[model samples]
Target: MGSGESTTRKVSFGVDDEDRVRILRGIKLSEDVLQRMRGVANIPPESSSSRQQTILKDELAKMAEREREAAREELVKTMSRERQQARKEAEKAKELAQQLQKKDSQLKALDAFYKEQLAQLEQRVRHSHMFHRPAETCLNVKNQSRNTAPVCPGLQAQILSCYKDNKDQTLNCSDLVKEYMQCINAAKKLFCLLINSEYDLNCISIAVSM
Candidate 1:
């Protein structure tokens, strides 16, 4: 046939036709196609065979539906498990944050206590006449002592005067002893404060170490 030319063939169902010629001309034909041709030729449907095909199609549809349902259930289970794990992780993070905050509060308290002790020490040293020497003389004497050299008489006199003040106020005859006593007292007070603190020391210690 030419590209633009339409070809028509006459056919009769009962006799051999162009379709039969095509089927006979080395063309493969399926059973379904043959059955459809037979139906077009007025062949009767086989009850048993038709029913069996219908049943097979229904079974396949049902199996497909079951497979889809199973996949959906698996997806739901996976999502639920992930949600639970996420919730647990979030809870853990919240607990860790709370613990960190508590530790920060404890450290602040410790710093405050140290500042109070230092302020008290500074006050005591500043107010004392005997232990109080001019800044320049004190620095010179301290440097001379470090070099193992003799200090000036004026510097020595101021040091001696400060030493007498230290002795008069100290436990025995030394400012070192008085400082020790003050430190001891401060330590005792700090222990009491730690005990009364809201958070326990053990927990704070662990957080700081980590």
Candidate 2:
């Protein structure tokens, strides 16, 4: 019996040893898996800092792009305003030029009208002088032959003097012009009557001689 008990105790001891071995192996495998997981979770400091820097650079680039877009929009608006102002100024200049051209045309037309009036006045004065000289010569010859006073000589001199004094303003001599015209008509009528009477006298003398 003593031998059998000892043998059983030895067998039981062997079985406990095997179970301990298996539990130790299982713990070791779990520790290895935990170590691998820790290694994967831990990152290098340089790599972390580099990633942060890359993200910061990307943010700064985006900000810069936004700023550039804003500046472009502002420039476009400013250019548009400048174009509009230039167009308005050009229109104003065109209008002013048109007005100046119109005024110039009016001045030229007025100048032409004044020149025409002056030319007509000069022509009338020349014709009056021609008619007056012939009438004066005839009146003088008739007066000498008839043994009579000169006709309207004083009035003729006065009219000529008035015309010379008021050359550019001939209307100032209107009163003198009317009086001189009346004197000339009377002289013409007197000359015609004298010519008719002389012709009758000559005819009577010719009959007597026959």
Candidate 3:
């Protein structure tokens, strides 16, 4: 009976040792699973923060590009306005130059016309002086010789009358001047013939008396 009780106690001890090994293995596996779950949970927050930073950077870049485009558009508009204003000013200057040139031409034409009129008046005055001196000499010669017929008396009277009627237009007496010249020439020829005839008569009378 002693031997059998010893054998039974050994069998009980072996069964208790096998149950402790299984329990230890189960506890180790549970700890490994809990650690892996904690690692998965921590990774998500870091990844989400990185994604938010990328989105913010993209928005800032887009805003900068829009500002640059607006600045370029404004510069183009300002340049266009300046060019239009310059063109208008140039056109106005050209028009003013044309007006000044036209006025200068008109002034030159007027000056030439006035100068021509003055020259004509001076020539007329000289002609008047030439005729007046010859008329006065003829009158004196006529006063000294009352016995001889006055040379060109009627034509001289007509010339004087024409001059009186048209004081400013002395050229009106051209026909009277021509008649007076012809009368003077005829009178000179007649005077020469009369002098020759008188000399011949005197010679005849002296010879007959002798």
Candidate 4:
């Protein structure tokens, strides 16, 4: 190369002052590169991605509703079981109360029946005691204070026969005993004779009244 001659080569791309001459001669951008640059500038919004997000949200909501329904169903089943148990308990209590009332009524009836029987038995005993006192037997025996004789079997037999014939009276033994006592006192001397004669008659009247 001769002294003072140029040696720098000029280029278009990446051009500095050495390549500036080549760039001025002819420098054009490629169509494919220009299209890629325009695509970057006009990027579309993420509308499809937003739609997917909305679909996912709807599915989650449906799932939440299903969970709530399941939970409500379980709660209803639990409450129904509790209510049924309570109803059974209430019925049992009511039955127990009725049984107790029945028992009380039966006891009261039995008590009243027993009391009636007792009263009847007492009345019979009083009547028998009043009518069957011993008499003084006066035989000519030495050093005899008073020979107390037991009730005559024949007289008692007659009286028993009379009572048996008329044994349906409501009168108690006390009433007949009181009447017979007064009769005996009024006829003290002939008391035994009168008693033996009217044993059946008096006893029958007493039994009928009783």
Best by lDDT: 2
Flag regions of model 3 displaced more than 4 Å: 1-33, 38-60, 117-210
- In candidate 3, what residue range of length 10 has the lowest lDDT sum? 7-16
Stretches of model 4 off by over 4 angstroms after superposition: 1-36, 40-66, 121-210
Question: Candidate 2, residues 27-144: lDDT per residue as tens digits?
Answer: 2334445446446543435678889999999999999999999999999999999999999999999999999999888866755654464455445445543333323333334423
- Writing each residue's lDDT as its tens digit, candidate 3 over 15-99 gives 1342221232222334345446445432323578788999999999999999999999999999999999999999999999999
Compute the lDDT of residue 11 as modeled in candidate 4: 37
TM-score of each: 0.35, 0.38, 0.35, 0.34
205 Cα displacement, candidate 1 (Å): 34
Candidate 3 has which clashing residue pairs, if any?
none
* Residue 102 miss distance in model 1 (angstroms): 1.7
Q: Residue 159: error of model 1 in Å?
A: 23
lDDT of each: 0.52, 0.57, 0.54, 0.53
How well does candidate 3 match the true structure, expressed as C-alpha RMSD? 21.1
Error of 4 at 14 (Å): 15
How well is each residue in 155-181 modelled by candidate 1, as lDDT tens digits?
A: 334434654665333322334434444
* Candidate 2 structure lDDT: 0.57
Q: Could you give candidate 4's per-residue lDDT for residues 60-142 as a string of tens digits?
A: 99999999999999999999999999999999999999999998888667556544654554455445443344233312224
